[model samples]
Target: MSNASTSPFPLAACAEMLWRDRPIEWRASRLKELGFGVGLWNWPEHDIGKLEATGASFTIMNGYLTGRLTDDEGADELIRTARETAQIGKRLGVQRLNLHGTGLGDRGLPVQPIQVVTGVMWLKARDTLSRIVELAEQEDVTFTLENLNLPVDHPGTPFGRAEDTLALVSSIDHPRLRLNLDLYHAQIGEGNLVELCRKSLPWIGEIQVADVPGRFEPGTGEVNWNGIARALKAMGYSGPIGMEAWASGDSEEALEAFRAAFTI
Candidate 1:
């Protein structure tokens, strides 16, 4: 990373910490009480103002890109959800929304046939994306396409790689549609994190972080923050950095673990 200075990194919480294995409610006030910033996903619409009063801004919360594509009638549901989230976030003063680009499935060993079908699926997925972008744009929130990590335990997904993510962004060519890079997902799905971030500096809109091996904290695992952090700094990113990790313990303990990890 050839940068003269490193930008300040903001610590934020993602939905999994609050809603993965437990209730997602009460996350905002808990964060406010604990003095944390950077909203991840599933923000409480009921008390968004109070959450904002805690001096935290939303980085990127979940969106309905995929949810809108599920059923024929789901389109309306997606629009309504996005509109509501945007209104709630706007009232809370958040600027970004992160969405899972598309779905993934199993592939064979050769993977040739699978790639072809997946490519077609990804192309079809553009229709869903178009709807999402239009809604997000109208709502005044930046929509970022999050790259899938392939589940490793599952199968192949259509939009898992950086190349695929960029391809979708290029295809859509919408100002609201941009890159939402996840370090843990990239570590699991792509190669050479620093190199990839360098190559993709221009496309990245927001960065969500968690360490590798177990998606824990910085020093709690094998992820090399020294290089990635330097590369992010070198790329001149000044957006909110989020914690999109799972809580191995209770919420407070998990928050403590994350805070401890940031100290590294």
Candidate 2:
């Protein structure tokens, strides 16, 4: 649990979202200097050695390169890639490895979109996550399944809603496999943010935030992030809160706004 005097939750910001023109290592180092842990997306796009040199506390990163959650072949590929990515995650000392319902492509669209998810697909997704849990246990790492917004960000993505993710993770009920409760997506897909957090508290490994209108930092848009911060503190959630948002203007100012929102 984080100390209330310092921060209500351990804070992190996505390096990929900040300083788009700067070098990745420079962004990581700057984030560290600003007292926030760093979050990463796909590892292959950047140099691991450079990231390690920055000495940032890596909070999370994408778990697999390419795979889906609702089929045998996709599940197998997911496991294999996740195993490989775990090695990189360990190398960087990343706290949580993130997963989506399926692999994302250009502009966050699902590579293999599904119009309807069948009952068998649900069963298979559950079973597949169980296998991921086994892999996580074997590798001594934690994996988080994140919910995505279908209407705006990920159209036709099956099992992309918070309700579906909560159902799956709660069913598994394993520490190695937890929910990466992304409030940005939830706010867009379903608006009862505080209530959603209350329901997801048990299975949440971490919480991600971004303002609703522009996917920018806290206080720049519609979300009452400070109120939600208080709500999370009241709910006894002392885990990582990551800012996975773009800078509306200056990146440093954006980060400061994020810090203020969750600082309690």
Candidate 3:
């Protein structure tokens, strides 16, 4: 296998979503051998010693074990767990730690669903993120808040929309805290991706992708990933772009399709 990137951007694939029959370390090692970084979900599910032995460059992983961004109790837990995860992330040389508006439960549903986000809730969420920024700065690590889709995958998740995440991230305007900017979720919750990326350019720590309607690799669904790739290149946004999707068939073929779509 060749270990060279065709795209200018640093490409990664979530190991949790690919090669389901293989061991996690095998998946990570394979991705690294194929010239891609690795992404993970919750770290506790895998063996840290084995992961370290694989020597994969971990791009991102879930930053918290359990917590929400909208309330006091949840915020406290979020901070504590994120702090602990930061240590593990540093040990693994992971680039960014990922977070959602709230902890996701079985089937990616919100553990604590919110029907309406009041003005007070918005203020609280921002304050919570500010504290997260403090933790990031102190730990010398970056944390990203990812946008989720309400209509399809994650319903009732506070700040799940790209607009909401942008508002919150831009309001904080800190380097340690940045946006994960999942285009798959943005496509489901809001359209106008190019424009959204333009608006999100300054605060993006990383970009995540999966084709819409199936959460599979780029060519398997109804997303113009090639066009988006061109647009991103034109905008001078060369950063990490991760494939957080499942394989429609063969995982290797799926990864090749993803690389092709982003290789402008």
Best by lDDT, which number? 3
Tens-digit lDDT track of model 2 for 1-264 = 222346868899999999999999999999888888999999999999999988899999999999999999999999999999999999999999999889999999999999999999999999999999999999999999999998898998889999999999999999999999999999999989999999999999999999988899999889999999999999899999999999999999998898889877
Candidate 1's residue-wise lDDT over 102-144, tens digit each?
3221331112213333444665567767887888767777877
Report the Cα lDDT for residue 175, model 2.
98
Off by over 4 Å in 2: 1-5
Clash number for candidate 1: 2
- If candidate 3 were superposed on the true structure by all CA atoms, what would the RMSD be? 1.0
How many Å off is the CA of 188 in candidate 3? 0.8
Please provide, for model 3 over 36-95, each residue's C-alpha lDDT reduced to its tens digit, 9 standing for 90 to 100.
Answer: 999999999999999999999999999999999898999999999999999999989989
* Clash pairs (backbone) in predicted model 1: 104-157, 105-156
**CA lDDT of 155 in candidate 3?**
95
Question: Which ranges of candidate 3 are over 4 A from the true structure?
Answer: 1-5
Regions of candidate 1 where Cα sits further than 4 Å from its true position: 1-7, 15-35, 43-55, 65-80, 103-120, 153-156, 247-264
Tell me the TM-score of each prediction against the true structure. 0.72, 0.98, 0.98
* Clash counts for the predictions, in order: 2, 0, 0
